[model samples]
Target: MPFDDFAHNPRTLLHIAGALRNRGVSPLELFRRVGVPPSALLDANGWVPRQLCFALSEEAGIVSGDRFLISKIGASFELVDFGPWGRTIAGARSVGEACAVAANNVELLHQGSALRFFTFARHAELRFEYHGRLGASPHQHLLGSMVFLRKIALLAKVPEAVSVRLSIPYSHGAECLEETCGPRLEFGCDYDSIVIDRSILDASIGDVGPNPIEVAETAEATGALLKRLLPYGRANLETVAAHLRVSARTVQRRLRDWGFSFEEILDDVRRTEATRHVISGENSAIEIAFLLGYSDPAHFTRAFRRWTGMPPRDYARAFRSNYS
Candidate 1:
């Protein structure tokens, strides 16, 4: 797949980066190894190669004993693109109807993640399984998956989830995990899963007051916007403007109205992805630097230090220590 086609959402990348940082991998080094320029981390509209993304995950697995990339990039869930889909679910007459919509049409929004709903008379369960081989840094994927599911449930207004499960092993932040999972999370399970009361699935969504046609149009517009901004991992303002057949000034103004600059969004993407690679401990810092397009390891090192306060080696060591 083209690097830019991977749907460059910075928030997703940020979650990945934060996971790696927590595990002791320098974000800059990870970016460098992945062939992403350090500057890209700051370019809100920048994109990175999909191969590099996979590589980061693979390397993390080797170094960190976790395969987060598979769950993160391989899995399909997106909040930005979910505007219409969420509205559709929100407009559903009942919980089962909403879930049916999610089951049948999630592909209309995202293709990477799978949603399975098991409805029994008394209880209902929703299991989101990420398809594909596990990446080196799966913890980032796990965390992101959890967060995404929680958000979905919250948006759907499920009264409460009975439990949440993760396939990856436990980490240091139990308290934080509980806070994120809402006091009913069960970690270290066979699969990443969530259990909800069946009654919630029957509850009416009420009116969200959005037109389905307008929502669909908005989704299409957003997809087109992402395509232009992320074009195959080459995210320069000029390039983006050219792709959109618009002037650079117009693009800048549009982004400004969104309360972000292209540069800021791109940087966020790079840093976020770098963190995921670093934490997974699957790739060498040198390799990651090269993958990210940094010719000089020293430059990568300096940047990594700035991003995570430690060199790549130290970061990897710390991550292994905590998890192993």
Candidate 2:
């Protein structure tokens, strides 16, 4: 399949790229192997193709010579590692509130994944629905959920021993899962969930100091950006302002305050999208030009050169040579 079918947060891939880069791996080669364009990392609100996520995970395992690399990487993720979404969770009043926020907004982290919260008299469970691609391992999903829940507990100052337990769908030797997470690993379970003591639910968040106002401001800025890119191909000022239910002057003023302009945002998105399409080794410059709203091939060629300091053909060649 081509790289355009499924989309996900590009942050994970950026993290993987950084890790691999530190280990003397060529980032371009990694992107080539995964059929992702390197430019996808620049736009924080942008999504990369999901196939790239799977390929990067598989390649990370192969390169590191560690079959458990997925879990290891996921376990090492910090609360701040999740960007704005993590801050939103951290800004909540309590652990339970954070869990609810995460549950409600998991799509901001990963598009196809779901986090469900269930509360009982004694405990609460955070269940994860990975919705991973066929034949892809679910270890990353499991460990990520565990680490996220553990961080929540830690942030809330809950005792480690009795506060949280983990249940996973697959049995990866009780000892291994126990070591990756903590002691309480229930393998061979129907769902991947983290069990937490309900008593800790109301505990005030202690160490992870967060500013709710910052979170809201960030969200507002992000929403404006998303609004500009809605339908992607149509990125005019009037349309975006209407979509945001505001006047064009207001939208312009707000984005200007944030050091943004509609033309700049549209051009950035087109550049990113154009790079992805070109690197797939499927579309020609002419096809991609039209696909990205450029009616004139010469105009697109100039814009791409301005964005990348090279012609699209040359850029595509460099990307292809990485894998070849």
Candidate number with greatest lDDT = 2
Off by over 4 Å in 1: 1-84, 108-112, 156-162, 206-324
lDDT of 1 by residue, 53-95 (tens): 5555556544555544334432334443345455566666776
> Any idea how many clashes model 2 has?
0
lDDT for 158 in candidate 2 is: 54
TM-score of each: 0.48, 0.61
Please write out the lDDT profile of model 2 over residues 141-178, one tens digit for every residue. 44645655666656656556233344444544546655
Winner by TM-score: 2
lDDT by candidate, in order shown: 0.54, 0.64
lDDT of 1: 0.54
Instruction: Output the worst ten-in-a-row residue range by lDDT, candidate 1.
Output: 212-221
